[model samples]
Target: MMITKEQRSLYRSEGYMILPGVIPPAMLAMLREECSYYLGYYDCIMDSRGVQTENISHRGKRYFINNRYRLSSRLWQFIFSDLMAEVARATVGDEAWLMHEQWVVKGAEQGMKFAWHQDSGYVKWYNPTTQHKPYVTCWCTLDEVSEENGTVYLLPHSRGGTKSEIITHIKEDGTNDLIGYTGSDPGDPVVVPAGSIVAFDSFVFHRSGPNLTGNMRRIYLPQYSEKPLTRPDGKPWAMATPFLKDGKNIYNHAEDSAENWGPFPEDKNVVV
Candidate 1:
C-alpha cells in the first residue's frame, strides 16, 4: 500500500500526512513534462488576453491553472493511478470523485505567496449551503520544495481549527486569495523531495511563501471528494469524474466529457 497505517492515523488526528518520495520515477518524469507544457499553455492563453494577471495568475510570477485534465495525454495516468486510488480510499473514502485538479507553479525569483485558507473555504464561499465531508488534497510535488522556494505550510486541526468545520474566509483585495486564518501561528512547513505527496484535509489551513531561488517550484495538485460536491442550486461545483467506487477505479477515459461528468460550474470566481 502507498500509505502506511501510521500515516493514516496521523492524518486522522492532525488533518494531514506526507508520503516521502513514493511516486514512481517514470510517473514523476511524465508529470514534469506535462507541467512544463501546461505552464506554456497558460502563458499563451494569458498572452492572447493581453494581460499579465488573470485572477490568481501573474504572467511571470505565479499560476493556479485549474481543470484541464482531459487535454493531457498522461495526467490521467497519475490522477487515476493505483497511487491515487490508495490515497483516496485512505482519506476520502471507498467512493471518490475528482473535484478539482491544478498546476500551481511558482516562477523563479518572483513567485508570489498564497494566502492562508482552507480548501473548503472556497466551497463555502461559493456554495454556502452545500454540505459535504472534508475532501483530500493530494499535493503532488514535481520539484524538491523548501521554505525558500514556496513550499506549502499546513496548520493542523488542533491549531488552526476543527477539520469537521468550515471557517468563513475573506477575499483579499489584490491577489484575489481568500484569507481564513489570521492567527500568529507560523504553521508547519513541508520540506520534502520531488515525487512526495502531501495529503491534507479540505479544512486544513494551508499557505505557501514566495519563491526566492532561481529555479521554478512546481506542484500538481489533484483534489478528491468522497462523493460529488454540488451547489445549492444542484449544479456540480467542479469536475465529478468518477475515480473510485468500492475501492476500485471506475474511470472510463473514452466516455469522459462534460456531458458525462456533468457541466462544469459557470462562475469563474468559484475556480479555486
Candidate 2:
C-alpha cells in the first residue's frame, strides 16, 4: 500500500509509525513457520509453539538469529515482496535498498530488552550517497505483542537534538548500553497485533522492557536504505545488496550488487 501523508509526517516527526496489518496473514504465517528451523536447530526446549528456551547464540542478544534473509528463500519472499518495495518507496523516496534483516525472540526473562539506541550511531561507518542520512528499519511482529510482552518503546521524533554518543562495544560496556541520552524523552511502549509493521527512522531512539509475560516475543526486522558509500570496518552491509533497489525487487531479477564482497563474519552480540 502507498504511504499516506499522515504516515510520512508521523515518520518525519516521531521517527516511527506503526502500520497496522500491512502484512497479510498468509505471509505472516509463512514467516512464522520458517522460525521453527531456528527453534528446533538451536538447543531450544519444547513449548506450546514446540520451542521453549534459547540461549544467546549471536547478535549480542540473549535470543535472536541474525541475517536469515541473506540465505533463506522463504525469508527473502517476505523481504522482496511487492508490498515491501511499496513501503520502501514511501519511506525512503524511490531508491531504497533493503540492506539488512534479523529475527529477534525476546524470551520471558529479566533484562531481556533490546535496549535504547539509534541505528545511525551504528552506521557511523556508512557513507551515504543521499541527503536522507541514516537508514530505516521495519520491525514486523510475529506474535501478539504488548508492553508486557517486551514490545519496543519508541521516543517520538528522536532523531537529533540529543546528548548521546555511539558506544563501540555494547557487551563490553556492561549496562552502559542501556543508559539514556541527555535530554532524551522516555518512550512509549508500542503495542501492535500480529502481522503489523513498526517502521522507524534510523536515528530514532527505541528500547524495550524485559518480558514479564510468559510467552516468546517474536519480531522480524528488515532495514531499508540506499547502498552504503562504504561498508563498516568489520560489520556487514558495508556495501549494497539491493533486496529492494529503486523501489523494485531486484532479488527476483538479475544478480544483485554486492560490490564483489561476500558474507562477513557474524557480528559479536554488540547491539545498537
Candidate 3:
C-alpha cells in the first residue's frame, strides 16, 4: 500500500488523489456489511424505486461480479481488494490489471442524476496517445461522502483536456446547466470520508447528485489496466464481448471480480 513519491506526482500531475484510510477497518466492516445485506435483500444495492432490471447499475445501481474463485465474493472481495492493487502497482506500473467493477448507490432519498461524463466515455474502446493512455480508477467511499449526500463532482486534469470543454447540467429541479467539456473543474463536494480513496483519470470529468442526506452514498468503482495494454483501435482492451461477462449483462467493467481474480487479502489475515 505504498504509492508515494508525492502520490506519484499527484497521479501524474493531478488527475486524482485522496487515498486517506487505504481501507482496513476489518475490510471496511466486511464490505459495509455486504453492502447492508445487498441493500436490504436485493434492492440490488440501490434501486430505491426506479425499477429497471438487467442490473449493471447506473440508475438502479447493482453491478457486483466475481465469477468463480469464490468465497462470499462480492465482486471478488471488492475488486481484488489488496489495498487497491497496491495503488494500482504504484500508479499504473507493475502490470496493473483489474479492468472493472462499480457499485455507486445513493439512497437517503435517491433522485438519480449523474451525467457530466468521462469514464473514458463509457470505458474507452481505444486510442488516446496509443491505446487508452494509462487507465486508472478507484472511488471507494462506501458511505460518508457528501455534498449534502450526493458527492463526487470532479473534473481533475480532464485527461489531456478538450473534448470541446464545458459541462455542468444538473437539472431535474437541481438546476446547474452549463454543458461542454474537454477539461477543468475536477472539484466540488469532493467530501470523501468513510474510508476514503479517490484516484481517478479515466479521462476524469465526473458527476453525481441527489441524496439530500439521510444516509446512503455507497461507492466502490474500480478499474485498472496496464496488462499488456492495447486500444487506440487495436482491440484487446479486454472486452472482447460476451456482452462483457461477469454477473451476466449490464454495466461492463469486464464484469468485475477484479477483472477475473487477482487482488484480495485484507481478510484472510494480513500477509503480503
Local distance difference test, per candidate?
0.87, 0.63, 0.54
Q: Write the per-residue lDDT of candidate 2 for residues 1-272, one digit (tens) a residue.
A: 77789988887666677888889999999988877667554443334335343333322234556654544557767887888787777677677766667777766555266666666654542323213365778889898888887888877654444223333213224343433344456578788899988888776777777778767787887777765424434334433556554555667433532333366434322232
- TM-score of decoy 1: 0.95
Which of the two candidates, 1 or 3, achieves a greater TM-score against the reference? Answer: 1
- Report the Cα lDDT for residue 215, model 1: 97
Better of 1 and 2 by TM-score: 1
Clashes found in each candidate (C-alpha, N, C closer than 3 A): 0, 4, 14
Which portions of model 2 miss their true places by more than 4 Å?
Answer: 42-61, 109-111, 125-132, 158-184, 232-239, 244-246, 253-261, 268-272
Alpha-carbon runs more than 4 Å astray in model 1: 257-272
Per-residue lDDT of candidate 1, residues 83-157 (tens digit): 999999999889999988988899999999999988888888887775889999999999999999999999999
Best by TM-score: 1
lDDT tens digits, residue span 1-272, model 3: 67678877876776777787678777777778766655554454345665654223333332233222233455455555556656766666655555554445666665454556555554331233543554677788866777777777775563436233322322223322222343455455578568778887666566767777656677766666665345555644432212212222222444544456454421100000
